[model samples]
Target: MNRKTFLKTSALASAGILSRPFITYANASKYRVALIGCGWWGTNILREAVASGVVEVVALCDVHEAQIDTCAKELNTWCTDKPKKFKDFRDCIKNAKPDLVINATPDHWHALIAIHALNNGCHVFLEKPIAHTLKEGTAIQKAARANNRICIVDFHRRYSPHNVSGMEFLKSGKVGRIQEVRAFVNYSGNGGKQKPSEPKPADMDWDMYCGPAKLIDYHSGIHPRAWRRQREFANGTLGDWAPHWFDQILWWTEEKAPKKIFSTSTKKIHDNIQTVPENQLVTYEFEDFICFWEHSINNTRPVQQGENVGAYFHGTEGTFHMGWHGGWTFYPHGKNATTIHEDPQLDLPDGQNIKLVWADFLNSIKTGELPHADIEHGRQATNMSLLGMLSNDLGRSIIWDHEKDMVTGDAEANKLLTRDYRGEWVYPS
Candidate 1:
């Protein structure tokens, strides 16, 4: 089905009836699964997969042996069987031959790993901000379509109970026409000054970890969780956090992409150590409305007080704010209007709500239906953020021809749609 039809079906599914037949296999064997990346968030996804009790993890792959060992140890606590370990994802996919692959790798590695798994006939559970570049995201989406595989991006908020209710409320027209939206992530801490280059850890295959991205000198800060702040490896707070909120906007509005994007950023907080900006603001112009994305590492508090990382929708009647952790609140236009608030239901650990996503993934695999958080949606959300970054990098506003998937009137910006791959790693065509 096309996106519009699928969305309508999803809306009906949300209301009480499912448009498509949902198949369930009784007494069926568990699915064989393999996990790639094995980092902190990756391990969290793996934990959710194991918690479902319907999948057996057959293999684990990570460039860092220490990470693989750590994840394996944690898995031992949850499951009886110890999974085979591999330093290379190709080996894991070839040898273990899992029915499903959980690709929780870094932003840069997302496309290659997910496309490889999809081509190998394995359904994929991909982590969000789908890929490092726009072209790579498109390639992964194409691979999923070509392979006819179930590819679900880990946009867990789609499964959040309160978020679902919030969308229902928004659809009720209580908020009126939402003309402008503000998506932001403000935190008190800054990216610390870069540490001196260090020798590569013995357990890490640093070259492989860098993968398609340029391989720079090893530093402790660049490994584990710090890669998010590095430009070569990830897209800072905008790439890390904006996709979730941008995705919410896309889902609520049913908009494919923005018409134009402009961004400006500052790196004054850090000693020019990090390539990504410490404070940034991006503006995206859609046909009907506009969105502003901002991130400031030096902020003492959030713009909406309690909502440090969330989006605010401004409508004709009132405004609604969706907090990342706290529940949503709605405020009327009048001064005397009473505000409405809802407490979040924290049923799952860390408010992840990923188990619900995993259930959808498994169901999609069984029924051959597209998942709610499909790879195409993931690509759109990721592209929104990537365009913002591209605008900032080019230091100018970019007019985007969404149909053409290219920046209009700027050759330099258009060229940045895909980055040059390092070494023998070919860019996905």
Candidate 2:
């Protein structure tokens, strides 16, 4: 269904939009965007940003010279000219002087790059899991606030039409009060082990790739996608995927920072890897509701939404299932399950939710309004996953004092909330 038809028939029609618009205080004709991290996802952002028609991509930044060169050449295939390529992020921002930087680097580099971009007086479109650590996430948010800049975290699910409709329906009270939420991700492990340390590739700057984190030996197994499993580089599967699922549930329920969290996990596979869980389960408690999230890299269990990864929200009246692929369904307590339609155009080539997120960011820049997936939303989601990681590490439950934003009465657990950046990288004061 189209947007209008869906809105008119939606249960939330009278309840109002899932996302509230920010008051715009500025005006701009077009935005200049510089993209960092020319990996698979990064290149896609470049294409979509160009397609958005609201920005011009002036620079492509990546530590891997080969990756950035490939991206620049790819852009040349369609456009008459390609963006300038840079190995160092600082140089990209300095020379390009873009109004916005699309940061798709790994989790560890997010905060540092974003803070620098903000220092240069540029807005930022940062990818999920705001930073490698909770402290960095907060710092990134503060930098944006201090600079009076727009920072939109790429929690793409928030821009999903069907997911938005599902949230609206829940808000309308048709399903009664939500009592619990369950999210799951069951995927085959990416791969196993690495090819040991070797000389760094000529086309890559290994030191730059390890920015902010300790410089580990180069290994072929760590690059491309395996980096998600590394503790020092990424947040594992929980950090990589939970942001999307958790972000949806939190936004749907309009909740933040669970009061308590407990989790358990094991590294059944890839024991030699320095990454996170191979399988895990976590439970979070709110004032009136509860949430459960689990994942097994080696299992393909039957899921609530018939999709490998999704969320099921249980309520008094029935249950709501939202898929990562962009569709929602309502299973009434006693009645038959019904499918809900959102904007059908969401399936178009450049009309996917990620593109919509870009559109929202672009609109936010032009109008000086906050994007639908704001930094705070991203921070909450990231914090939730980080809490789960902490619980697993401690082998116990964590009592969260949200107001103070720390783990209560546990010095050791609290210390894990932030990381000590290595080399020249330092947390901004």
Candidate that scores best on TM-score: 1
Candidate 2 lDDT tens digits, 25-118: 1133167778899888887776666655456667899989888888887776534444688999999999988998999998889999999999
* lDDT accuracy of residue 139 in candidate 2: 88
Model 1 C-alpha lDDT per residue in residues 300-330, reported as the tens digit of each score: 4634556788889999999998876788889
The regions of model 1 sitting more than 4 angstroms off are 1-29
**What is the alpha-carbon lDDT for the whole of candidate 2?**
0.78
Query: Mind sharing the TM-score for model 2?
Result: 0.89
Q: Rate the local accuracy (lDDT) of all candidates.
A: 0.85, 0.78
Number of colliding residue pairs in model 2: 1
Candidate 2 global Cα RMSD: 5.8
